[model samples]
Structure formats: structure tokens, C-alpha cells
Target: MNLRLYSYWRSSSAWRVRIALGLKELEYRYAAVNLLEGEQWSEAQRARNPTHQVPVLEVERAGQPPLRLVQSMAIIEWLDEVHPSPPLLPATADGRARVRALAEHVNSGIQPLQNAIVLKRLREKVPGWDRAWAQQAIAEGLGALERAVADGGAGRFCHGDSPGLADCYLVPQLYNARRFGLETSGFPTLLRIEAACAALTAFQAAHPDRQPDAPSSDPATSPATSPAAAPAAAGRSP
Candidate 1:
């Protein structure tokens, strides 16, 4: 199979897919989508994803039309099933459900509210929109995540000793939370799992600052300036 990933350098959703690809050891061409500059809304990109979001995975096989996948979670799950070694989901049904639930706590609950477009909208529509609103949303979601991990679902990495789906979701959200200045001092188990995941080369390589599209000098200093500067935010998946 041939694979190509359309991603933004700093997008957490795209970062999640990148981590999954790294863990699965899948090689793919990187197509940088500059979200901050509104490149995602371009006609060509819109053709790839109607929702105009980053992290579209184009899959090609020997005798089939190119499969265009939109959501980050769906793309990662497909990769886990097709690749199979070092499985991302657990073996048992209960285990898979738990992992999926943990992942969704971030994917569905936290990520949607913290997306760039949503925040942008809130800023324009709401009265005196502040970064505090985003921070509060992040804090609430992360609090739940902390409890989930502390309650029973965490090990060295969110499920068991090895990093899996939940770790994929956890690491990126933590990255974004830090970007938003959400204090994470309360979530020790989440922090511990994040630290464990960070030790892995896959997670390190998939980091927002490590992407080719990110500015070589400083990723945070520049944004909404160039494609290189376009990465410093969270994303929505079409």
C-alpha cells in the first residue's frame, strides 16, 4: 500500500496520526497543509476533505481507488488493523472498549472544543472571549482524564506497559494543554504516562516541533505568518 499524509506541523490531530504511523513503522510522503494561513480551505485541499481540516490520510493499494480517510482516530484504527504488529488496541473486547473510551475522552470531548476554528469562532462571537475559556475546557477534560487514569486504566502508558491508542491521544492533548498554559500539576498519573510515552522514539519524532513543516529555529515565535509558522495550533479533522 502507498500512503500520504496531509498534515499541519502543530496540529494535535495530525500529530496523533503521525504518532500512529511512527509506531506502526509506516513510511509515507508528508503533505504539509498550512492551516493558519487558511491553506486547508483551498480548492485542492477541499477536494480532499470537504470539512476543510488537516490530517487527511490518502491510502493507495494495488487494485483500488485511493482511499481518502478524514478523522484522525479512524485513520489510526485502520493502521492498527492493517499493520497488526505492536497492536494499538488491546486483544480483548473489554480492553479495546476501555482504550477507545479513553481515547474518545480526548478526541471527542476535549479536542473538539479546543480546535482552532472553534476558539476563533468564540473569540469573534462571544463577549470578551479569553484564553481562559479554552483553558477551562481543557482543564475540565484533563481532570476527567486524570481521574480515569488514576482510577484504574493507567499503567506505564494509559493502558498497559506499552504505549497504545490512549497514549497516542494523551500525549498530543498534553502538548496542546501546555501550549494553552493549562496547569497540569493536578494530574500526576497523566503526567507520568506522558513522561513514559515521551521516552519512546516514535512519540519524540511525532512531536509538533519535530515536524519538517515546523520552523527550524523556533516553532512558537512565529504563527499565521508562513506555512512554517502555520503549525502552532490544535486542529479539526474533516
Candidate 2:
């Protein structure tokens, strides 16, 4: 089978897909799509996903029909199914439900709130929307995650001692949290879980800054994912 990933360096959703792929040891051709430059809105990308979202996975097998999967959560779950080793979901049915609950908490409730598109729309509708608002939204959303992780579950991971789907979802959102200058010190427990996740090679490799399309310099200094500062090989699909 051949896998193709359409991704942007700093897109949190794309970051989630990459983490799942790395944890499964899945080999895929990385196709860099600069979302900020309206590349994701291009006809070619729109053909793949009408929503024009990054992290679209194309599953191609020689004799079978190619399937396209969109949305990070869906793609991650599919990755677990395609490559069972180092499974993303927990083993037991109850455990799987619990993990999915935590994942859904972030995936559905927290993540979509601060996504690039949502933020853009928010800026238009709410004239006061700014970095401060982003900082507050992230704090509230992730503060809830902190309470859930602390009171509910997560061992070395969200469900148990091994890294699973929850970690994959949460870490990238934290990357986005950092971008907004969210104060994570208030949520010590969540930060602790994130610290552990950051140590894992899967999470580390999945980081946006580590992606081929990421800037060589520090992102905190130059924040735009703008195509102007794009690297020479930025548009190529590998």
C-alpha cells in the first residue's frame, strides 16, 4: 500500500495525523500544502477534500480502489486499524470508550474552537477578537482538559502507561496553545502529561517545527505561516 499525506507544517490537525503515523511506524509520502497561501483552497486540493483541509490521507493499494480520509480524528483511527501494532485505542472496550471520551473532549470541544479557520471567522464576526481572546479561549478549553486528565484518567498517557490516541490529539493543540500565549502553568497536571508526551519520539517527530516545510528559524520570533517566507521546496509533494 502507498499512503499520501497532504499537510501544512503548523496546522494542529495535520500535526495529529503525523503523530499517529509516526507511532504506527507507517511510511507515507509527505505532500506539503501551504494552507496560508490558499494552496489548500486550490482545485487540486479541493478535489481531494471539498472542505479544503490539510492532512488528507490517500490509501492506495495496487489492486483495490484508493480511499481518501479527511479530518484528523478519522484519519488517526483509520491508522490504528490499518496498522494494529502500537494501537491508538485502548485494548478493552471500556478503556477504548474512556480514551475516546478524552480524545473527543479535545477533538470536538477544544480543538475546533481555536482552529485557523474558526479564528479567522471569529476575527471577522467579533472585531475585538485578537491574540488575547485566543489566549483566553485556549486557557478555558485546556483547563477543562487538565481537570479531566487529573480527575478522570491518564497514566503515562491519557488512558494508561503507554502513549495512545489521546496524547496524539492533545499535544498538537498544546502547540497551538503555545502560539496563542496561553498560560499553561495554571494547569500543572495537563502540562505534566504534555511534558511526558514531548519526550516521546512519536510526538517529537510529529511536531510542526520538525516538518520539512517548517521554517529553519524559531517560529516564536516570526509567527506567520505565510508563504512569503516559505522555503524553496515548500510547494513540492514528496
Candidate 3:
């Protein structure tokens, strides 16, 4: 199978897919999509995903038409189904539901509120609302996640000792929380899980700083770098 991922370096959703692909030990061509410069609105990108989002996956198999998949959660689930050696979800039905619930706590409840497009719209209508809104959303969502993990029989990772779907959703959201300047010391459980994930090469390779389109310098200080202009060698492997 030939796989290609359309991703933005700092996008939490794309980061989730990156982590999933890495954990599955799959190699794919990295096609960088720069969200900072409105590249996601381009004709080509829109054609790939009408919603105009990053983390679109293109899959090619023998004697079949190529498949274009969108939405990070859907793509990751499909990948997990196709490649089950290192399962992303638990084996038991109840366990899968628990993990999916944890994953949705981040994917549905939190991410949309702080999404770039959502922030941009808020900024246009209500001046100076983006940062505080994103911070609150992340903080509240993470607070709930912390309590859920604390009560949900969490072990080394979110579900059990294994790093599964919930962990894949989590680490990136924590990154976003930090980027938005939220103090995360309150969520010790989530932080502990994040520490465990940090030790894994899969999570390390999926980090925003390690992406091909990431700026050479600090993204906060450096001017926006176009993915089209950058070389695609950085994310060639896990």
C-alpha cells in the first residue's frame, strides 16, 4: 500500500494522525499543507477535503482506485482497522467504548472550540476573544479529561498500560494547551500520561517541531514558512 498524508505542522488534528501512523509503524509520503498562509482554502486542497481541513489521507492499493480519506479521527480508525498488529483500541467491546469516549472528550468536546477557523471568526466578530476562548476551552476540556482518567481505571496511558487511541488524541491537545499559554500543572494525571508518551519514539517523531514544514527557528518568533517551499524530507519516516 502507498500512503500519503496532507498535514500541517502545528495542527493538533494532523498531529493525531501522525502519531497513529507512527504507532502503526507505517511509512508514508508527507505532503505538507501550510494552514498559516490559507493554503487549505486552495482549489487543490478543497478538492481533497471539502471541509478544507488538514490531515487528509490518500491510500493506494493494488488494482483499485486511490482512496482519499478526511477527518483525523476517521482516518486514524480506518488505519487501525487496516493495520491491527499494534491495535490502537482495546480488545473488549467495553474497553473500546471507554477509549472512544476518552478520545471524543478531546476530539469533539474541545478541539472544535479552539479550531483556527473558529478562532478567526470569533476574532472578526469579537475583538481579543481568541486567546482567552482557546485557553478556557482547553483548560476546561483538559480538566474534565483529567478527572475522567483519574476515575476511568487509567494505567500508564489513558486506558491501560498501552498507549492507545485516547493517548493519540491527548498529547497533541496538551501541546495546544501549552501553546495557548495555559498552565497545565493542575492536570497531573494527563501530564503523567504525556510524560509516558514522550518516552516513545512514535510520539517524538510526530511532534510539531519535527515536521517538515515546521520553521527552523521558533515558530512564535519566526515569520510564517510555506510548506510548499520547504523540503519534504523531515517526515519521511516515523
| Candidates 1 and 2, the one with greater lDDT | 1
lDDT over C-alpha atoms for residue 72 of model 1: 91
After the best TM-score superposition of candidate 1, give how far the Cα of residue 44 lies from its true spot, in angstroms: 1.0
Counted clashes in each candidate structure:
0, 1, 0
Candidate 3 vs. true structure, TM-score = 0.92
By the TM-score metric, which is better: model 2 or model 3? Answer: 3
- Candidate 3 lDDT over 182-224, as tens digits, reads 9999999999999999999888888888776786545442223
Q: List the residue pairs that clash in candidate 3.
A: none
Regions more than 4 Å wrong, model 2: 217-238
Q: CA shift at 220, candidate 1, in angstroms? A: 20
Off by over 4 Å in 3: 217-238
At residue 224, give the lDDT of candidate 2: 27
In order of appearance, the predictions have TM-scores of 0.89, 0.87, 0.92
Candidate 3, 110: how far from true, in Å? Answer: 0.4
- Give per-model CA RMSD: 5.7, 5.2, 3.8
The full ranking of all candidates by lDDT, starting with the best, is: 3, 1, 2
Residue 36 shift from truth in candidate 3, angstroms: 0.7
> Pairing residues by index, what is the TM-score of model 2?
0.87
